[model samples]
Target: MLFLQNKKFSFSILFLLLLLTFQPLSSSQQLKKNVEFNTSKKDHCQKQISASLLFDITLHGFLLWASMGFLMPVGILVIRMSNREQCGRRLKFYFYIHTILQILSVLLVTAGAVMSIKKFNNAFNNNHQRIGIGLYGMIWLQALIGIVRPKRGSRTRSLWFFIHWMLGTAVSLLGVFNVYSGLFAYHEKTSRRIRIWTIIFTVEISLISFFYLFQDKLEYIQKQGVILGSDLVTSTDQGLSPNDKQKELPTDPC
Candidate 1:
């Protein structure tokens, strides 16, 4: 009986040791869980990076569009239209519009330049970056030229205007080209579509160009219409003084 009791105690102790050695979760499972968690963290980080890049791109593009595309073009149009008008107050109003719009455009451009320097990569390897540098320099130079204008009759005034006109034209052309290049760059970087945006910009430019060309010929077109000269002559005869009528009568000399 004593031998049988020892055998039972030994069996129970061995069972307890076996239970102590067993693990509900293995080391391999814990490693796999850690890897999965780390993978999810990395994925979340990538998503945040993409979102931030997208925001930066959107803001930069908006600034460029407002500055170079919309505001500057409208400013040019206002200045051009102002030249066709003779009223002083109306001319002043157009001048004010042009000045304010240009100032706003410069501010927006400065903002975009700041953002580009801070947020974007400065590799300068692409056409977009190259053109942007030139375009911005030309814009600033154009502003300076506009500010230091000579009087209308001065000898240098003509030269100044020539330079200003050329620079303005170049900047406008280059700005539009840069915008197109930027769209392509964005697509290259983010693999996104830009067809509709391109189309919209093209249509807007076309309308502005149409108005610009049409305004120059508008006066000529108006002059081509028929006039009522007979009514003007009758009105002039009715408004004549009595002495002027007496001078016109030859029968009184007889």
Candidate 2:
């Protein structure tokens, strides 16, 4: 009887041990499946979020690049080329075009900036953001300066002109750099291809730069060959000795 009771108790304990071990195995398997399912769902949601982010980034990039890269430079170029036009109406037309384009560019930049703030909810978090903010400020300031241009011969006109020119040039250069930074950021965030865009942008910049240099050098070269003949000779003669004046007579007009 004692042996039978001991055997019964050992069997009961063994059964409980088996139950506990086997139950946990099953529960652990179910838990693992649940976790995997949850992980998969999370991954799917993340993918959706990434897609939306990429779209926003691309849109922002387009707006920024269009404003800074294309519109601003082209507007400035139009103004510069128009200055050489002798027709007042034509010059005015180009000036109006430049103003319109610049305004459009500013609008685009403002849109981009609003979008950024809406999406990111933070500013100056990075170099790109800081530079972009500065660029926008400078661009608006430049536009204001242009609008309030001083009279041509005012005492402050020269200072204003220099300030405007320097500020504009700095903004343009900084804007180009910011565009590149934006491209880099876009690629880093989206892992998208940037080589084609980079190449195209580089080519565009090269063409613009070439045209600007050509215009500048062409003007300089033309001026170099200009013979202001009689007027220049007479101007020089006023400072010369009589013998020097006589010697210059053949080259001068009476």
Candidate 3:
């Protein structure tokens, strides 16, 4: 009977050891489950982050496009066409509209620049990023130029006009080109289609270019009209840029 009791005790000890060993197995299984759950959560968060990045990139492109591409060019168009208006409130009104449009453009571009700084890494390694940096400096320079503008008949007015027109033209062209590069970058990053957007933008730029050049050549197209380029240049207090209005004909002196 004593031997039987000893055997029972030994069996009990063995059972206890078995229980301890299986406890670790259960814990290890639970740990594996936890690890899988965490991994899935991490994957979900990464997807959300990627989606957010794409949206922000798209917004950046849009802001730049509106400011530099659309608004700036339209402003130039407004002022250019307004040179045809007789001196008075009509010209002043056009000027006001142009001023308003340009102000809005600057505001939009500033917002875009801020977004790029905050959201993007800004390595500036690519043409798009490099162009963007140039655009920022040029924009501020243009603003300074606008502020320190000379009086209408001042000697520096012509020089100022030249710089303003040339720089404005350059900004518009570069901005448009940068947007195209941006679209390319977006496609490379996201592997998404941008063909529709590219086509639409191309159409928009073509239309604006057509009107800009057509108006410029309208004087020459008017049935073999005689033009006196240099003599008619100083007709207004504000010197017309030879580049902008070289085709203006002389006023009939009766």
Judging by lDDT against the true structure, name the best candidate.
3
Every model's TM-score: 0.79, 0.71, 0.84
Better TM-score candidate (2, 3): 3
Alpha carbon lDDT of each predicted model: 0.87, 0.87, 0.89
Task: Order the candidates by lDDT, highest first.
Answer: 3, 1, 2
| Residue 120 displacement in candidate 3 (angstroms) | 1.0
lDDT for 41 (candidate 1): 100
**Candidate of highest TM-score:** 3
Instruction: Please give the lDDT score at residue 59 for candidate 2.
Output: 93
lDDT of 1 at 126: 96
Off by over 4 Å in 2: 1-34, 121-125, 151-155, 219-254
C-alpha lDDT (0 to 100) for residue 61 of candidate 3: 91
Question: In candidate 1, what are the lDDT values of residues 173-253, reduced to their tens digit?
Answer: 888888889889998988899999999999988988898898898877766542456667778899999899988888754
lDDT of 2 at 36: 100
Put down candidate 2 lDDT per residue, 1-254, tens digits, no spaces.
99999999999999999999999999999999999999999999999988887788899999989999989888878888876787779988998999999999989999998888888645477789899878878888888998998876799999998898799789889988999998887787668899999999999888988887787787777676675565687787787989986876776557
- Candidate 3 lDDT over 88-189, as tens digits, reads 998998889988888899899999999999998888889999999999889878877887879788999999999998898889989999999999999998
Location of the lowest summed lDDT over 10 successive residues in candidate 2? 222-231
Candidate 3 TM-score, true structure as reference: 0.84
